[model samples]
Target: MGSTSKMKVLESLGPLLVACLGILGCTQAVTLEVKERNSTCIKAELSALLFITYTTFNSTSNVSTSLPDSTSVDAASSSCGAAGRPPWLVAVFGSGHALGLSFATNGSFYSVTNLTLQYNLSDTSLFPQSNGSGVVTVVSSSVGIWAPINTTYRCASPTTIRAGGAAVTFSAMRLEAYMPGNDLSPAESVCTADQTTTTAPPTTTTTAAPAPTPPGTPETGVFSVTNSSGTVCLLAKMGLQLNVSYVSQSQNKTVQELVNVNPNLTVTSGSCGGTTASLVLTQQTTTLNFTFSMNSTTSKYHLSGINLLANWSDMTAPFSASNTSLDYLRSTLGRSYMCNTEQTLLVVPAFSLNTFRLQVQPFGVTASQFAAAEECQLDQDQMLIPIIVGAALAGLVLIILIAYLIGRKRSHAGYQTI
Candidate 1:
């Protein structure tokens, strides 16, 4: 089939695969446990978003898909490494796809040796060709680096490993291997991207005026989700900065990238409901979706969830966070919640958001202008700090004055009746 026709077929089958695998029932976590003679030798837990890319029938373009959350380890086929042999684990998806991981350890440290993905191309409902079952090695490494015995290994950014015509990407990954016990704890060793800095030539100094907004700084603007009748149901105004961590494929190190949400960018889509509303913004390879929910009893609305997906040139697969919960940006109906100060909203282990000059009114509103304002926690805290400090200073001043007055009385008592 032609590429266009093949894509159509795959698109049609997407919903079917979701049903066959019961995506809602699938868990995005995988765990491996190895025991020897009643003692646990290795225990690894991994929770992340996984993506796979491959080619079939000598196609020029690659086919990519995310591994379903329902995938689970095949304990029967997996084994622990011993002596000269290496340890391997196999995970099987309901769609007949299998992922395998091979590990190498030299007592002090351990590393991944290979990542293999197996699929049956003959399954017309999935792949484009009927090439029987094929196995592809997606990643291979000869060097060993993960160290220590009990600490978990964390790579909050996306890491892509490519081998031959296949590639695999793992994001927001946490793994614990060669564990002395069964429980998992905080990781001490973090994988980060390499950085190179260059010294700029010295320049003449000048008087600094009020600094203007930087060239690439995001500007705040009002965005609204409207109902079928054109009535606005949800409104927001903010300058957003998305922070994502990923391993650079070229540098082989993890790096954090901040992406600004251009307020000028058009809203791709949105939905407005009585109790819930959503707005989606897309710019280049990054897409952000913000969701809001209303509390009927309190007559207030709040930012309830966030979903972000980004595809960077330095990485092989897309970095994504789906349905991340949030508890801030709240205000009563007709009132806009405002925070002029910068605030951070941690969406997930791999993603966070920095919002500037945020103002949102997710429910009833009279005009485009803001009504009664509600202060954000950060702004309220900032205001409270000054008041607290002023009160403390006033108390200190009062105590000093009282002590001086008492000292004066004591001195006069010792002096002659002047």
Candidate 2:
């Protein structure tokens, strides 16, 4: 009889034990949320997605000589741009070396700065289908500069880019990069000239060289620090409107470029967990806020907040915190991926970027607390099952006790009557 009772007890608890184990298994796969600042960098490597030709040149005091060697790199050979079309992504890598000694030949060096690539596309067929515009231009700044000896880099331009035509040729095209020594900013001149002009090519070239170089124009803007890796991740915008002119000695003319903040700006949030974050930005307001969420157990994080502001020098358009709207951009329930592991820099469309840093907000979740929290959450639903069983058992005991009392009362009455 005792063995039978023990078996019965074990059978009674079997289902409950299975339920608990099921809950534990589910907890292991919970989505992790991180609410605070932690550094994780995602590697972002861009492939060239266009048809490009590279011609090496050696400059001297008397005349500029172009090597007989010219190589045309077809974007179709690489893993970038749209299929069955010209390349859309233009990735350029630079290094510091003797410009006159190495670049003049086919050699590279250490410590290069301000590696940038600008693209201009005029052909209508090359125009991106999304934005039906005849002109497409993009510039990348503050790239591949931080390295001990040399840094090889790749950056993607804004989406839906088209470039080059048969008649329009980029003459004297060079890479514009600067080295630390002598403060001589190397300038790559991608001169756009019509191929139809059947004239003698000019011997003189306008290169970004040592001193007596073009005036260094410093531009400023505000960048939001939504998230970042351990290293500095910075993003800024064009805050001022200015038309600057440059003297092109090779062309013997003045060239002008315009820098202005978009009156209306739109930024699409990144996709995480099969969804996307999005916002519309404007220059009239200030103050941007950020909110983040972290799960200690899983070490996962998410962000939500309003009115997060990034301030920079010389903001021509008035931006006040009061007028600022905070509901522009947001982070999802958990981290899309780890930070500081080399990820793509998400930028608003139609704007050129130079450099900025992003540092994630710090939120720490401990293992002890994580387990406790998970247990509590599980108890909220499962606790009802145990409570109902306990209530039923108590009711059964009460009925039995009442029946025994009734029997005793009847027996006492019978004895009194006798």
Supply the TM-score for candidate 2: 0.20
Record all residue pairs in model 1 with backbone atoms less than 3 Å apart, i.e. clashing: 157-245, 157-246, 158-246, 192-254, 193-253, 193-254
Model 2 stretches with alpha carbons more than 4 Å out: 1-379
Model 2, poorest ten-residue lDDT window?
Answer: 97-106
For each of the candidates, the C-alpha root-mean-square deviation to the true structure, in angstroms, is: 22.7, 29.2
Clashes of each: 6, 48
Per-residue lDDT value at 344 in model 1: 86
Residue-wise C-alpha lDDT for candidate 2, range 185-304, written one tens digit per residue: 333211112113345456676664432333233343333322212221222232233233344333444444333434244231111111112121223222122233334455544433
- Expressed as tens digits, the lDDT of each residue in 287-401 for candidate 1 is 6777677777788888877776565788744466744247878878768889989988888888898988888776675555567788977898989999999999999999999
TM-score of 1: 0.46
**Backbone clash total, candidate 1:** 6
lDDT of 1: 0.61
Using Cα atoms with residue i matched to residue i, what is each candidate's TM-score against the true structure? 0.46, 0.20
Task: Summing lDDT over every window of 10 consecutive residues in candidate 1, give the lowest-scoring window.
Answer: 136-145
